[model samples]
Target: MMTLYGRRGWGSVLIEAQLAYYDLPFRFEEVDDLFTSASARKALARINPLAQVPTLLLDDGRVLTESAAITLHLADLTGRDDLVPGADAPERAAFLRWLVFLVTNLYPTFTYADEPTRFVADATAAKAFRARVDDYAQSLWRMVEHAAAAPWFLGERRSALDLYIGVMTRWRPRRPWFLAEAPKLHAIAQAIDAEPAFAGTLARNFAE
Candidate 1:
């Protein structure tokens, strides 16, 4: 069994999706908003110097951080490596490309959109920063729409990239401007949410 330390955020949702996909038995330790609290900070530092949630503690006492790394590690452990492309296969290169693309391009845009003030000191500048993020997010989703082969990011099988993209797509509708710009992504999100494991998790989390 694994113990997952997570908050109710995108990273946490990705961890949950991976657990469900792998049918891995695990305990969820809620990190909550106490990430800044002294105790939470101390405990996280002891496990991961980054003091990040979505940290996984393996049964053997090893700790894993970074959602992508954790998901890939769990896939390997459960012999579900087919969810990820094999290293020698052509799809493997594409898989790595999209995985990094989601992390570097899409994820950062969401982070900036969620917390605009972090990037700018002035209130006016922060609003402008948010606007820029909104634009970037739309462009990013359009890129995803072009790259996605339909049914899944990597075609039939659900990859870690799909889980990441699904979470982000679900989040877009909450933003008024981005929601209107993301029709294709919205469809992808619906498809992901319709999956039994994902729907079950959403129902449990949001009472849907």
Candidate 2:
């Protein structure tokens, strides 16, 4: 069985949801907060140099990091394009486009802002940096909102993009912001949140 090292409500939840969607058998290793715990980072670094969650140790022993890589890898392993568009599928290009866009364009905002002190030496500077990043993230979401298609990011078909929206909208500007400013993306997120297949997985990871 594979082992997934992650924390609840973190980026790892994204992979956890995908694994559940694929019905893949895996054991979860709960990691401590990467931002606040020294030992947690040290422990996870042995498995993943970056000490990042959602790190997957495949049954074959190969380690996979980065959510996008894992997302594609899972689809390849399952040979089912239910969540990811197949190579020749008409939605393939759009799926890849938005997938990359989410990871590269938007995900980094959280990385920088969530721990602004890591980048900005001064506390006051960190606050300013975080505020700017938040604003920039909002602008980036606007781009996604404009490109978003009804019912799903790709329209008429659900893909990993919906999963991404579901989790990401929970961060930074959050759901309320998306609901008001990016209703299309917000609708897609709501659809994923209501998906029965992910109910148990989400509940465990997002339990209050």
Candidate 3:
């Protein structure tokens, strides 16, 4: 079985959902807050220098970092296109485009804004930077909102993009903002939440 190193309710939920959706056998290794705990950072650094969550270790001991790379890797491992569109599938291009757009354009907002002091020394500067990042994240979400289709981000097909929408909607600017500003994406998130396959995973990571 694979081992996933992550903290609850972090970006690792995306990976957790997918692993569950595919019925893959994996164990979750909880890491303490990367931003606060020295030992957590030091321990994770040995496995992933970035000390980022969603760091997956295959049974063979090879480590995988970056959610996007791991997303593709999981698809390759399962050889099932359920969550990832196959190359010949028409949704392939759009899927690849938006997947990269999500990781490159939107996800970084949280990376920077979550712990702004890591990037900016001054408290005032960190606040301003976080505000800018939040504004930028909203704009990026608007772009996704426009491109979003009903039922799923890709429309009629449930892909990892839906998983991303579900988890990310819970982040900065959050579900309330998405409910009002990006109804389509919000609806997709709700749909994913209702998916029985991921019920346990989502509930565990996003417990109320």
Show where candidate 3 strays beyond 4 Å. Answer: none
Give stretches of model 1 more than 4 Å off.
34-42, 173-180
**All models: lDDT?**
0.72, 0.92, 0.93
lDDT of 2: 0.92
Question: How far out, in Å, is residue 76 in model 2?
Answer: 0.6
- After TM-score superposition, the amount by which residue 134's alpha carbon in candidate 2 deviates from its true location, in angstroms, is 0.5
**TM-scores for all candidates?**
0.84, 0.98, 0.98
- Candidate 1 Cα RMSD (Å): 2.7
Poorest lDDT segment (10 consecutive residues) of candidate 3:
148-157
What is the C-alpha local distance difference test score of candidate 3?
A: 0.93
For residues 11-103, write the lDDT of model 2, one tens digit per residue.
998999999889999999998889999999999999899998789999999999999999999999999999999999999999999899999
